[model samples]
Target: MDVLVVGDANPDLVLRGDVRPRFGQAEQLLTGADLVLGGSAAITAAGCARLGLDTLLLTALGDDVFGVITRQRLEERGVTLLLQPSGDVPTGLSVILTPPGDDRAILTLPGTIPALRPEDVTDAHLSAARHVHVASLYLQPRLAAGLAGVFARARALGVGTSLDTNWDPTEKWESITDILAYTDVFLPNANELRAVTGSTDVDRAAASLVATGTTVVMKNGAAGARAWWPGGECSAPGRPVDVVDTTGAGDSFNAGFLAGRLAGLPIPEAIGWAATAGSLSTRASGGTAAQATRAELA
Candidate 1:
């Protein structure tokens, strides 16, 4: 395997246009609604597979309709699934409300999202892959608690590890330093970088993290992405595109960067690939709907 992705895998029910909720039994009309594959890990895996990487997604899912849909969508994208059964609990689900020209609000039921444990990622799994990427760290508490050890083990086997901790609802950015000690790459958005490092200045936050020997990749939305390492840094401007939905653009960017690194591209060129992939993903409604292929990224 070229990459092993560990994290959440579920279906996202996306509703667009005038999505703000009203109280007192008020009913609102929506412009569109569609159920599609989501979860940071799943989207990143799909993006890697679309980029021609041999990707394997290790996640927990229930035997439910949503689980079935998630499986089908991932398989269609050529991602190999390593299923972890979530006994009794239904699969996790997220309802994304995308208001016109505004940021989206997500309501999530973390049914199986937090089910994955450190033991689930066996030594065999780590040794088989050239790289391992973990996503949605806040959503998977059990795995997050022990991810440092997992990454350390991967590093011992000469495998690279990266992490993208999606938003933390608790607002407590804990245990990140330990994880970063073993992480080769750390991906985060501007807001998350500040939150994790407790520094409002992006440069300071990224530099602090880079001091620990891990590459810090900050996603700057329209401004594009920037990366900082011990002795160097690079950046790429975002590609211009008509964005339909910004659901999984960041995750796609993570995939592109990792894919480029695995393929021996330099940090600056990889940032270009990351920006292009992220911009192209927003061309459709869902996260994976308009994800770029290898040719498209080229």
Candidate 2:
């Protein structure tokens, strides 16, 4: 595999329209509701596979209907699955309430997402990939604990690693700071970057992370994405497309950038590819639905 994506494997129960739930025995209606393959790592893995990378996804799911659907979706996108299917628990699930634009509210049930341990990244997992990516850190307790060893082992084998710290439900962003030392590429959207750093200035927040010797891919919705490293910075304007849902835009960007890097594209050019991939992802109701392939990019 060209890259291995480690983290949650789940399905999204997405509803489109004004999805705010009211209290006092009120009922709401939505124009559309669909169950689709989801989870940050799964989406990115699928995106990479669709873009022609030999991608492997290491995640945990339950031996249930959702898990079956998840496996089918991943395979349909040509991703190699190394999933841990648990008979003891159910698959993770996220409810996405999209309000006619990019803005969305998500409710997640952790389930088996927190069951992946560090031991999951063995010699077989690390040796088969040139790059390894992990997402949804704050939600995966077991995976989070073993993350350091995973990165270190992958590094010792000359493999690069990236991390996408999706929203922290607890609002405490301290757990991820220590792991940046092992991360080669850190992909975080502008809001997450700001909140993680507790900085009002996004650029300053990015600088603080870059100071740790990690390349930061700062994703700014519509404005595009910027890559900052030691003494160098590159930015690209996001491609404009018909808006649908923005669920996996950031994960798609991560896949695009990593695919570019693995294919030896220059960093600036890769950021442009990432921006384009991210923009294209919003054209569908689900996160991976409109993911672009390498041909679409041209």
Candidate 3:
């Protein structure tokens, strides 16, 4: 399958601690840090590669050390890198603080990631893909602003479109309504959906999101996920995986779900596979640490 993943690219520096420090209070660090390729698109693309897909990643990275590492990692994963030249800015970096529990916080810098534009993605890139996944729409303005047009073009080229609605504090969620008109499948976690739609009712929110002409997969972490189409809905219960860090779980879920779809599995089965991938992702230090392969999912 030809899968295109576009959006943010960053290096994640994860520091594992047993307890979160109080304001100025120092805590003992249990595990040493590990640097890994992160960001929604990057993790998703890596997971896709692990699933044995022909994946292409379109993104922007700065000319710094972090950028170099990001590119090298992508190449090592066998993902085609369609990188745009970043002017003077540094590559994006996320300082991931993962406490002993499953929760974590990210201190991130967009750096050159916000510069990915429509011109960065060529007609060839769109036409060559059977499926295109647009990620972090709210975090990358240039790409995010032009997403609807991009999806429309991809559709004309007979490509299916999926969107991973990563969070943006300043996102105009209502504006995203228009983009869904061209999106075939919409993937969002529970919190992201709540923030975007300003509602807590999953059914109501899923219905509202699907009303905009997109199939909705409302991801409720740890509790499993829900998939809503026009005529029907399906849900898969979350598996009990030993939780470590909850960083890249959602992105991996997207990869597993897409992999299932490409393999011609039913939606319910796809969601089950997706949840398994997500749950397995939490067994290590960082987001991609415990990434599961297709064989593992099966």
Candidate 4:
């Protein structure tokens, strides 16, 4: 199936330090540092392409150095690009500091990523894909608000929809209803589910999100993922692999799960593919590192 990934594309600068520093203090540095193409959609699209899918990235990139590097990285991975070029501002960039086994803090500049609009995605592009996955909704207000119309148009053309929401407690979730109503699949991590639904229990959170008019898949990190609908619940365990970095695991999981589902696999099997892909992604540095191929996933 052809997959169209619509969302953020940012260059990720990773710094490994021994201990996370306090607000005013400096940190002890560790060795392994590298740059990679990140942002939820970019990573997921690259993962999908690596897993042998026909993938296209519908995103905005600045006419700058970071954008050049980001585009080069995506092209190197064989993911097709549908770029909307921006000349006024630089491309989005994220500074990620991974201090051993924990969640990393991200400092990002929206740059060109938040500038994507419905008009930016042409009908020819939208109609060409079987599935359109748009991610990081909270990070881009205009695109997030405009997604309902895009989904409506895609639905008219018989294309399925998926959303990988990033956490933004600031936006009113009420505004997301229309877009969610048209979504075929909703993919969010456990924390994101809570942020979107204001619930703590995994089942309750998933239920609340699914009630918003789409099937829910809650990515529960090390515990695996929970896929649910009105009357059914399916869980997949995380694969045990030696860890290096947890940067792009969730995005890779989204890629694997969607790839499996598009191939007509059962929900349980899809989650298994997702979990393994997510786990294997951490074996190397950076978000796109160590992403598995279709053969490896099989």
* TM, every model: 0.98, 0.95, 0.94, 0.94
Stretches of candidate 1 off by over 4 Å are none
- Local distance difference test, each candidate: 0.93, 0.88, 0.85, 0.86
lDDT of 3 by residue, 139-164 (tens): 78778777888888888889999998
Worst 10 residues of 4 by lDDT: 18-27
TM-score of 2: 0.95
lDDT top scorer:
1
Model 1 RMSD in Å is 0.9
Task: Specify the poorest-scoring 10-residue window by lDDT in model 1.
Answer: 168-177
Q: How accurate is candidate 3 locally (lDDT)?
A: 0.85
**How accurate locally is residue 215 in candidate 4, as Cα lDDT from 0 to 100?**
85
| Candidate 4 clashing pairs, residues 3+ apart or interchain | none
Clashing pairs in 3: none
**Candidate with the larger TM-score of 2 and 4:** 2
* lDDT digits (tens) for residues 1-298 of candidate 1: 9999999999999999888899999999999999999999999999999999999999999999999999999999999999987889999999999998848899999989999999999999999899999999999888988999999999999999999998898998778889989999999999999999999999999999898898998899988999999899988999899989999999999999988998999998898899989999999988999998878877
